[model samples]
Target: MAIKFLFFPFTHMNKSQLKTVLAFFPACHYLSMNRDFKHDPSLQTLFETGKINPIFPLPEPLEKVEQNFGQYLAWARIHKGNKVNLKSLLKDSPYFTDDSDVTAITSQIKGEKSDKEDANADALTKEQSLLQDLLFLKMAHLCDEQNEGIDLALNDLIIGHDTLIASLRGCQSLVSHVKDKKTIARKDLGEMMPGQRIRAWARSLSAMGALEPQGGTPLFITTSEAVFGYLEASCKDLVNALDIHKIKVHENECENKNEWQHLFCTWLMRAVQGDGIRENDMPVVDDRCSLLGQVKLALFSGNGINKIFNCSDKQIPVCLIKLK
Candidate 1:
């Protein structure tokens, strides 16, 4: 079997790797465009204004490239005025992959603590989870620095929302613990807003392409959960179809029964790493019944969430496909 890619959470990245990761965005604008950015009118103006004659000499060695990009990213904002396009880049390359490396680094973080780690040490698990969330959220905070940052933050959050939607629907397996969640009609989406985060998310959606109120992106995100009562309403048909009876271990009797939070964290971790989760390594509720397996089953079953909201909207088709 080929080796799995190790997703280094932003916390795991040193300053150099973090900035190098951020640099991918500005590099996108230049690299993907046909015109040489060096002689472009807007780029030249930026270089002159920022007093930075940007160079496109990305190093051949990954290590040197990391260092060079880190340096360039430090000034990318001063020159191009775009916020770090981390959300989309992360969606594309969430984890570091080496075909020869067999270790599952994120899995290891939850697998076993160091010999010195105490069970009570700093609530290490929670802290670790928050670090990932904070890193994704930092895009919002960082964008507050400039109007351009605001737009970037919004784009990041919008794209992040789309990415997660793809993952959930693609990997739909409804755990008993995942509450039945639903997204209302797009027109009705406004009634539930006003909470700071949701409002901000809605605003981002509104601002997506053309600035006109009606011309904005049709998607409006209200809550993060996507189950939408699919599990409770259809568990019987689903259990029989997947032949879940064969492997469905009773969670009530399990020692460390998985919760929504655990499954969620595991899912997000996999998404950030940009990896197809090994069927075996998905969040474990018990030896027989995997949290991810159940979710995927629930998603695939008929009369599911994908059928409900996504049938008409269908903005994000799938998120967890490239299973290696």
Candidate 2:
């Protein structure tokens, strides 16, 4: 089955209508798979014995850390700054008007002076470690909530909630740690330079009728601000064969998920099978592994499945261009 044919109809669907289509997509696709298996004994045997799985192999079980964000509380403890409190560093206040001032605070938090004076400085003394101790105790309480399984639906919600907050904090710590480090260079997308990426993106967009017909006039394409900036900087002065237009975007108003440029590019790459996309693109569930038990528990508890389909309505942004 060609994915283009399957998903092309979605371009016209509204949100609610689209959900209706998706609700039946899996069951319908599975019926096709079953029909194929029944018609061919070998294929049926492969499916029954799990020699070959359809579309997606079950995803490997979630790692312990992936299963619960509470584990990251321990991670925070392990990577915590050497300074136990920022009160003395900030002169016992929290007001910084400049990057330099903030840098000073972070430097003290990181114990740069202590490291210079003695690399093997002792951990913060208990008396000065009040804030750190309290923070850890709070995290420990969160971990206990998950371990105790207070309520299944509520726990599922907590897992997602904790992951988001913990991830944000973890990212903040990481960025601050490397604030003074040299910037890492962005790698090329496979072998394609920025210009090449733009050209290839144009080709796919045209195939999907995402390109605008300007009749020799320039037509602007829209994309997220990030993608626009990337192309502007990296693809400077690149010539185009198609009737050209500059990329346009509204920084604040643009919804990240609805970025048309990115959404179409993702659909093509995931759904279409050819030299351009995956040759074996199909509707399949990844191996559930140990996480199967967790999902079952959620299901039994009236919590919805957290399974990721091979295809979805809101795809991560791919290309940075869209026809305006």
Candidate 3:
């Protein structure tokens, strides 16, 4: 079939959600594979330019951490129910603020023709369930140092929750009347950063359509402290410098699924053709194996197919609906 086209009859993610999705993925975290896990050569300049002071431990290579974080997140977002609405999801939370730019993006996720395109609810539910399983595995890995059985325990506690979205707790003041809780655990508190970044990216993506919106435009704003500040600073710097007007959202790659599917196909094809990939081993083209699972998962969600596609499949039928 030479990969004729991929049909994606699904709602597209809005700009804010899409941008958040982008920002959620780690950039270039190339710490050495040795036990020391040294930073990438480029990171020295980035640290100096950004004046970075990181608080997280450097036990594992950053690529591993990023792989763990980004892949699970990408999968969760793909399989999340109700289209991963950062605006409405965080609207009532005191810790987060909704960006105005996400309005258009939200509208897009719902799709222009509701009668023509409604998402696969049952399939989404199934994906969310699987995401919970992945979450359990990740949580176990994170807590492996504390206890060997954490994964099994986490599986039971995670129960039906997809992400740790519900189990998290922060001490909102009953006595102090504080609007946002300050006593949140370091790990739990860190979750707010991604939420803020998601909206910020959406706003920036929205501005991409505008020819000029004035320089020094705020890329992202949040009350998150210095701990989560490291990643956010880089995110803001990148978006702040970007001219989104230059970016194009292709019609076939029009929806998030189709776009992701197209990208995944390109990646998988390269891996299959190149000696860089292996059957049982992780696929690493030019030493970047972490992204393979994410691409595959994206394709699965785009088409609501539960089965993982074989990397060696030469002509996977990825059809496109009539271009918008």
Candidate 4:
């Protein structure tokens, strides 16, 4: 007798459909190691009390999820700026805005000039300190909400909610320190602990074509891509969906043709391999190949048009130039 197991790929299914399938695969359920302790108590209570519903709606639409996550990142950036800017503005208003009128007004005040200057300086310092405190509170609140959103997304995915919450909490602490003026060392975004399971879940969602990783540390994004590729290949439908576009190579006609051609060829080869394309099937075009040549020219010509040229729905003019 031989033991056997079945694996069903449900990459294309939306949240509701995925839940239905997971319901039948009870053995596959695994808790995220990074789960938030604060939220975990409530979640466990809900589960124990039979309040865990099988059909809870996802917090946002699939297309909007990545956008929502991007908004969180943007909020993080703005929050950091708000702390620094608010503090600086209070400490030295002239640094942020013109204060010629204030300077003249201060000079006109006659009595107790030295005392007034000291008092003003003290007041400004206090205001800056208060603003810094408020910014930290706002950052903490934003972090909490973001952590909750991550958990909700994980709950939908059926993985990594706990681990994600823990990571978010850690991130919040690090970011809070970064916002404080008294902090001696600058917080390195890249130095944060790598939550491998959360990364995997994010990549899994990306592989399902439900999300896209935007701006982040290069190492994080690279590791995420590796995990995403693995999970994506696990689904036959996703693999098929990805194969619709193929990366090909062609020689470049630049002044440094040899170097450019070599680099382009190597990059194209890697892309093809990464996409699971067979070596023999990789397309090769001539140096004068219209589409490839145009793409190369576009890259050199300007920014913002690199990938747009290759998009399936793109339209380009087919002007004819004749040599005399």
Each candidate structure's TM-score, on Cα atoms with residue i matched to residue i, is 0.17, 0.19, 0.17, 0.18
> Model 2: per-residue lDDT, tens digit, 1-324?
222212210111222222322222221111010113465575465457643333311122112212223334443465468465534544565554322243332333333443432442365443223222222222332433343343444445655565567577777565444443323322212222223233323332333233323322112222223333444344313322121133222222233313432443343333212223332332222323111100000000011100111112222112222222
Q: Model 4, 213: alpha-carbon shift in Å?
A: 32
lDDT of 2 at 88: 56
Each model's backbone clash number = 10, 6, 9, 4
lDDT agreement of model 4 with the native: 0.30
Tens digit per residue, CA lDDT, model 4, 1-324: 111111111111222222322222111211121222345565454345542322211333322333433444554466565777646645776532221233222222211234545566555553333222222222333443455455456554433444456467777564544433221221211122223223323333333333222321111111122233333333222212112123322222333444444454343334423445444543344355332211110001112111211222221111111110
RMSD of 1: 25.6
Q: Over the full model, what C-alpha lDDT does candidate 2 score relative to the true structure?
A: 0.29
What is the Å distance of residue 106 in model 1 from its true position?
50
Candidate 4 similarity to native, TM-score: 0.18
* Top candidate (lDDT): 4
In Å, residue 13's CA in model 4 sits off its true spot by 16
Per-residue error (Å), model 3, residue 87: 26
Q: Higher-TM-score candidate among 1 and 2? A: 2
